[model samples]
Target: MESLRAPPTAAGGLFPPLPCALEALPLLGVDFSSAPSRQKPVVLAWGRRAGAVVKLEAIERFNALPTLAERLSAPGPWLGGFDLPFGLPRSLLQAWGWPLDWAEAMSRYARTSRPELQAAFAAFCAARPVGQKFAHRVCDGPAGASPSMKWVNPPVAWMMHAGVPLLRTAGVTLVGHAAGDPARLALEAYPGLLARAVLGRRSYKSDEKAKQTPERLIARKDLVDALEQGRQPWGLRLRLSHAQREDLVEDARGDTLDAVLCLLQAAWGAGQPRGGWPGDADALEGWILGAGTVPAP
Candidate 1:
C-alpha cells in the first residue's frame, strides 16, 4: 500500500492524478438511475474504489439491453454498492399481499414494466384516501423518500427491478442473498449516509448560478476540511486541487458531490482488510445494514 498522506498532482487544468494509495482499494459504489424514453430507458451508474477518495469511474450507461449485458459480463471482483433499494416497503407488500423478502419482492416486481408498475400502483392508490394511497418501507420514512413503491420521487422500486436482475445474471453475489456468489458482493448504500455525516445539511454543491456565491464556496471548503481531517463516518480522506475545488464549488447540480460520494465508497472498499476486495459473505455484509431482508433468488 502507498502512503495516504501524499498530495496529488494537478494535470492539464482539469485532471489530477489521484494518490497512488487509491489503487489498492477495491470497493465500488454505484449511483444508478433510469432515464425515460419512447423505447427502453437508459441506465446510468458511477462510483469509485472503496478506501481511496480519488479516481472516480463510471460503468457505461446503456440504452440497449445487449450493451448492458456486455458490461455486466466484464471481469472483476467487484463489491457493487448500488443506490437502488433492495427491499420494498413492508406496507406496500402487505397491502398487495406480495412477498416481503427483498429478492422475492424484486423478482415479483420485475415481472412488471414501468407503465405496468405505474398503473398498478395508481390503481392501488385510487381505491384509498388521497394522502394514504402510497405505501412506504421502514427506510423510506427515515430516508424521506416517497413511498418505496412509488414510480416517481426517486422511483427506487423500478431501479431495483431493472438493476438487480442484471447483477443476478452477471453472477455477482448479493450481500444478504443466499443465492448470490460469495465472491462478487452487491450491497446497498445511500450517498446521504456519508454526506449528512460530514456536511449536515450544508449545501456543498449546486447547479444554480445564484446559489454559487462565495458562501457556497466556504461550504465546499468546509466539506473539503472535513474530508481531509477524516471527519467523515467512513474515515476516508479526499485530495483535491485548488482548480478542482473551484470547479466543484461552481457547479450547482451536485454532479461533483455525487462523484465525491462515489469516491468515498471506493475508499471504503479499499480499506477492507481482506486484501481490499471483499473476500467473503461476512466482509461483504459488514458494509450493509442487516435490518433489510435479503430476497431469495
Candidate 2:
C-alpha cells in the first residue's frame, strides 16, 4: 500500500494569510549532501521575488560541497534556507565535555572524521537508556526534525559536518550563526515542517524512481495549488509556468520541491523579527523559518 496522509487542502483555514508580498530578494533553498553524487547531486531550489509573488527561477545542482562554498562566497547578495543542522545538541556537547559555545564547538566538530564521529555518537547512545538514546537540540522538537547526531537513515549529522564548514568560509552571514551582512542571511530550513502543516502526512515524493506513482504526483499538484492560492502554513504564493510546475512535481527525488518549499519559507520569514527566528538563535540551536508554537495534541 502507498504511504499517504492528509492532503494539502485538509487544513487550509488553519493559518492566516502571510504578510503582503515581501520586498524582492534572491531566495534559495538547498537540499544538501555530505557526499554528493552525479546521479544524486545536491539541489538548490532557486527563486526570485516578483511584485506580490515569488517565482521559481531554476533548479541548480552541485556535485561537490567545496564548489558550493565558492558559489556562495562569490560577490552577490542572497538569502537562503539550508536543509541541514546548524548546531549540535547542547545537551550532547555538555554531556560529552565539548565546548558549549556554538562557534567553538563547530570548530572542533568540523575536524573530526566521519568514522570517528560515528563511533563517538554510537558510544554516547550506547550509554543512554533506550528512550533517551539520542540527544536533541531545542529546535528539533518544534521543527519535527530528527536528532542531529544521527548517522544513518538520512545522516543529517554528516550533512552538518560537511556543509556548515562551507557556510562559515562563504563570506555570507548566517542568520542564526552570527551577524555580518543582512543581505546574506543563511538560516536553517526544514521543509518537512511546512509540508506537515499543509499536507498533514501525505507522501508526495519519492527518491526511488519506481515509487514515484500517480498518487505522489497528485499530492504534489495539490501542494503547489495550495501554495499558489496563498493558503495557510504560509501565505506566500509561487509563480511558474505549467511546464515548470510539471518539472518540479515530476522529479521522484523531491529535491526540487524541497528547495522550493525552503525558498517560500525564506520569503515568509523576510519581514519578520530577525527573519522569523528569535533573538536567542545564534548557533547552539538555530530555529527553522516558520516554526512557531507547535499545535496542542
Candidate 3:
C-alpha cells in the first residue's frame, strides 16, 4: 500500500492518487433518487484521493435515468460509492422463496413492479412481530441504514430496485455481491453513517424549504470542517475548492455533500483488501462500504 499523501504536479498543484492498484481510477459518489426529476435529480460527486486528502473535482446532476446509465456504461477504472442498497436481506429472500443468488435476485427484483414490491413487503411486515417487522442486513445495524426492503420514508428499497440494475447492466462489479468489470467497481455507501459520527443526530439538511433551518446549515458547516481536517475513522481528508465548499454548504438538501461523503468512503475502500468488504459479508444482503467491523446478524 502507498502512503496517503498526494504528489505534487508540475504546475505546483496537487494530483490526488488512490492507493495501490486503483491509483489511476477516478472516485465517484452518487446520491441517487429512485424517481429522479429536474427538482430532485440524481447527484454525482466526482473526485480523487491521494494519501489523506480527497479532492472534490466536480458535481453533476442527472435528471433522467438514461443519462446515469450512459455515464456508468461509458466509464472504466472508476470506483463509486452509491447511496443505495445493492441487495436485500437474506432472511427476506428465503422467507419469500426469492432467488438467493445475487444476480438472479437482482434480475427478479428488476422485473417486479413497484406496487407488487410494496404489497409484498407490506405483507412480510404484517406477518412478523410488530417491533421486528423488517428483516435487516447485518450492516444495517452498524451503518444505521434503513432496511433495503423498506418502501416508504427513505424508499431505499425503491432505490435498490432502480439503481442496482443499472450497475448490473453497466457491468460494474458490485463488490462482494456480484462479479462484473473489475475496473468499474461499485460499493454500497450510506452517508448517514458518516454524517451521524460528526453531527450526532443533528438534522443537517431538508429538501423542504420550510424545514431547512439555520441549525442545519451550521451542522453542514461542522460536518464539512470535520471532513476537511480528516476527523473520521477513514483517516481521509476532503479538499474542496472555495466555490465547491459554498455549493455544498448552501445546498439545503445536502445531495452534493452526501455524494462527496460517499466518495470518501469509496476511496477508503479502494485501498483496502476486497474493497474493505468483510469476510462474513452476506452475498445476498451485501454490505455498506465503510461499516467496519460490524457484528454478524
The candidate maximizing TM-score is 3
For residues 1-297, what per-residue lDDT tens digits would candidate 2 score against the true structure?
111111223111111222233454578888888888887788888787765488888888988877887778775467788888888887889888998777788889999888999999999999999999999877787778888899998899999998888888776676655544444667788878777777777889887888889998988888888877766455668888888888777777777888888888776666565566654443566677776643311
Predict model 2's lDDT versus the native. 0.74
lDDT of each: 0.53, 0.74, 0.83
lDDT, candidate 3, equals 0.83
Best lDDT among the predictions, by candidate number: 3
Clash-forming residue pairs, model 2: none
1-297 in candidate 1: lDDT tens per residue? 422112222210011112234454344555555443323233333444433344444423355555654665666545456666665655567777877565666677778777887887888889889778876555444333344566775676677777777777877755444244443456555555566566676766544667767776777777767766677655666665666566545545554555456546545643443222222322111223222221111
User: What are the runs in model 2 whose C-alpha is more than 4 Å off?
Assistant: 1-22, 50-52, 179-182, 280-282, 293-297
Ten-residue stretch with the least lDDT total in model 2: 10-19
Model 2 TM-score relative to the real fold: 0.87
TM-scores for every predicted model: 0.64, 0.87, 0.91
RMSD of 3: 7.5
Q: What is candidate 3's lDDT per residue for 152-239, written digit by digit as tens?
A: 8899999999899988888877766666776677889999988887778789999999999999999999999999998877668999
